[model samples]
Structures are given as structure tokens and as C-alpha cells.
Target: MGWLALDEGYEISLVEGKVAVRRPEGRQLKALPKALRDHPEVDRLRRLAEWLERHEAACAAQVDTWMVSSLPVPTELLARVWPDGAWQAALRDLAVVPDDDPDEVGFLRDATPGGELKVVNLDGETVRLSPRTVTLPHPVLLPDLDDVREFAAELDITQRVEQIHRPTWAKPADLEPAATEVRDYAGGVFPTRFGLAARATGLGYRVSGGYATCKVRDSGRAVEAAVWIGEPYWDDETATGALNWHDEDGRAVRLGEVGPVAWSEGMRMAAALYAGRRIEEGGDEA
Candidate 1:
């Protein structure tokens, strides 16, 4: 195996039939195929592979990543056909109608050698099959069945592809396990982190069973506040507190509880207090 230092916080490790990403923290992130990572001229191949990956990601954002056969059609498009509402109940029998993309349909047909071939009628229905089965001739082919089996498959793929866009915000580096932070806070009458996040989000929290139980405003209503009381010490209903809350009109209600307020918020609050009055120099948020 050989290694090459690459630009932009990366180390590329190449073995006989594999290429591994040696992350900056000295961890192996992923292994790539030999064709891409283990060429005779490996340094050149690694650079090329990285560049191509970044380029494709950039391109996918601009061009809908779905509808790109290399990628898949987005599930959100299914929602467009079936937006959220009581009306969706009626569409229980309906199928996703795909747009006519000669290119995508042609590609699938070419890729599927010796697969079944059938001509679709002009009315966006199928004239093939003994029972005169109906179908829509868009790229997202949905087989017409009373059980709506094909529609379910199409919907699943669409949603899976759309999830690619969901935000994966990196957690702060100092995200200690909740139990440790909670235990320290529990030593005091009031858990420190619990107070801060509650104040920030306008919620309430308390410490019990080695965890901070808190409640927040959700959906314009209040509910139970949940704290992760140490698992071994907790009973099913004992750990959670029914949060006392008020509506905008000053009516009391219950909002659901959340687990120990996230430790990062607690850390930030602590740091803010430490840095008060601007006393010293280069201390960053822990």
C-alpha cells in the first residue's frame, strides 16, 4: 500500500485493489474501487477521481439531481403530483405520472436487455395485457395494479433521492456524551445547560434521575418535557415530566418533554459567562 497527501484536508491511501480516505483525524472514511483508485499512475488517478466527484455534486445541485439517471428521480416530484392534504386520500388509487423524457426512457430501455417490450397508447394508457391493463408512459414507469404496488415503489425511490438534500449539519466537536454533562449539572440544584436552552428557546427544564428534563414550544402548543434520566435508574413513565406551559393568551398547557438539553448549548452558555467583561485573550467556545 502507498499513500499520497492531497490538498484540502485529505490523505489518500492506495492499496492493491482499494483506495481509502485517510481523514485528517487519522481515520479511514471510505474505500474506493481499484479502477478509480489503484491505477499504475495512482497519484494522477486520485486527483482525477476527487475532482470528478466534486464536479458531479456541484452539477447535481444546479441540474435537478433526480432525472439524472446516474442519480434517480426525486421523490419530491411525487409530492407535487400528490401534495399533502385530505385530497391525497383520494389518490390512494392513483399513480405517479412521469414527464416524457425521451432520453431517460430510452436509456432504461437500452440498459435492460431482453426485458419485456410493450407499446403505450397515446391516451397515456397501456393497450397491452389480457385484461387491458392501463399505464402512464412517463420515465417513472408505474405498473397499473389494483394493489398500487408499482406506485409504492416509485414513491419510495422518489423520497429516498430527495433525502440527499436534507441538511447534515456537523455537530460541534466537543459534543460530550449527555450522561457525563448531565451528571455534573445534576450535582448542582439547577442543571446549567437545561436553564440556558430553555431560556433561549423559551422553554422550561429541571434535573432528576441524572438528566435534565425540558419542554419547548412545538406547533404553537406545549407538551411534556423529556430528560434522559439514566436508563438503568429509570422506569418507563418516571423520567418524563409533564411540562407546564402557557399559550400566547396566557392559558396553561402541556408541551412534550425533550431529553437533557443538548450539551453544546450548555457549553456555549458556560463559555459566554467565562468570557464576560472581555478579560483575556484567545479562548474559543468549547
Candidate 2:
């Protein structure tokens, strides 16, 4: 809106004080005027602009899939795609964990097909790593997790990277009225899943890269609940998770120990994510 306009394959932009016409590649430009509307160069730029726009959109969509899946990516593969500006931009700076240890997280800095992959380790040192697979971790599992989450929020990448660490109930043996409807995503960060994230955010909950968080009162006391979203392999249309609840003293509540309000809210959140999913005819979703 500030200066660029896309119509057909042509990009009409304001460069300095005059109208400039060119393809989205920013190559082959001509000054625009009413008399030059039929210029052959303008027609050529328009065609190139159209192709560029479509390619850009395709790249963005594919990158979105990679972020959502949090798949264990091969550095060699990334190196091949890194030549494309859009692809490189999307893959840069994401938190990655080596295939070996899920606990050792690093920030992806560079990739080389046959050379060492480079990353800034959790200790903030620049180092070359040769992990079998590099995975984009959900923000919840990153070093300085809170800070990483803050950065994601600033970039609005939360929902895209949903494979972050999910909060377990802390004591599975202590839970009561165990979830019969919950879908557990092994890579999911939410106990229930991602679909409910919007609803939680609309209700003033803090929807972070890994969880939808908020404090609710139960029996005149405040409890914190962090709802996790599951990983994509297990989550397709709807998302799910456990209700990680904290007591007035800020300790995790044991299973089946939550009061009426807390329990209702937890189930309600799960239901929100499950609301629009279509069940499969044979009991498996399509």
C-alpha cells in the first residue's frame, strides 16, 4: 500500500518521484506514463511479474508446511533449496535440535551439503555441527525458552511452529477423570491441539508458540493452565492436549483434583479444538 502495486504480472511502484514499471524480479524497468501504456517492454515485464508472484506464493505455502510439521529435516536437502531467497528466509533462524539429543537445542545458522552445518549452540557459541537430522523445534523446547517465545510472537510465527514441547500434567498417576476425547500428538506441544488456540487467544489467553495460557479461579483460588498443541503427524484437522493446572501456591494439581470451574474450562478448551473436525466414515479421519 505504501508504494508497490501488483496488477497482472506487472509491478507498478513509486521509485523516487516517478512511476516505475517492472517485473517483480526488479529487473527490466521503464518509466510509466499514459503514452507508454502500450510499450512492448511493459508487456514483457507484466508476464514476468505474474510468474514471479506465483512462485513466491508457492514457496511461502510450502515453507508453512515445513514449519507446522517440525519434521526432522536433512541439512543436505536444505542446502539444495537454500539458493531460493524465499525458501532460505523461511528456514533461517529457527531453533533446531539434533537427531541425537532432543535436549540439546541450537539455532540454525547455515547449512552446507558436504561440509559441517553451522549453528549457534545453546551456549551462544558459533559451532559447526553434523547432526544426522536437523529439526525445527517448537519454541517451548528452545534454550531461553521464554525469550525464544517472545521473538516468535514478535514475528507472529507461533501457530506455524506447533511442535514445541507440550506440558504434561506433571503427574499422570494423579489425574482423575482421564481424558477420553483427547488426541495425543507425540510431537505436539499442546495437550489438546492447535485449533483451540484462536479461541483461547480471543478470550484473552496468551497464545504462545507452544501453549495457550491463562489463569483461572477455582474455589476462590487462582490456577494457571497451559494447554499444549500436538505435533502434525498425529494432528490433521483438529488438535488436542492435557490440562496442565497449577494450584494457588503455584504447584501442579494432581490428576482428578481440580474443582468444578477448572475442570469445565479444561474440557471446554479441548472441545473448541475438536469442534469442526469431520470424523471418518470408518472411524479414521480422511
Scored by TM-score, the top model is 2
lDDT of 2 by residue, 208-236 (tens): 66666555455455666666654434444
Q: Model 1 Cα displacement at 220 (Å)?
A: 34
lDDT of 1 by residue, 83-175 (tens): 332222322222222333322121111101222222233233442221111222222222233224343443442222222222122224454
TM-score of each: 0.20, 0.45
Candidate 2 ranges beyond 4 A from true positions: 1-31, 113-115, 140-144, 150-286
Q: Give the Å error, residue 82, model 2.
A: 0.9
Error of 2 at 83 (Å): 1.6
Model 1 ranges off by over 4 Å: 1-40, 65-150, 153-160, 163-286
Give me candidate 1's TM-score against the actual structure.
0.20
* Best-performing candidate as measured by lDDT: 2
Model 2 lDDT, full chain set: 0.55
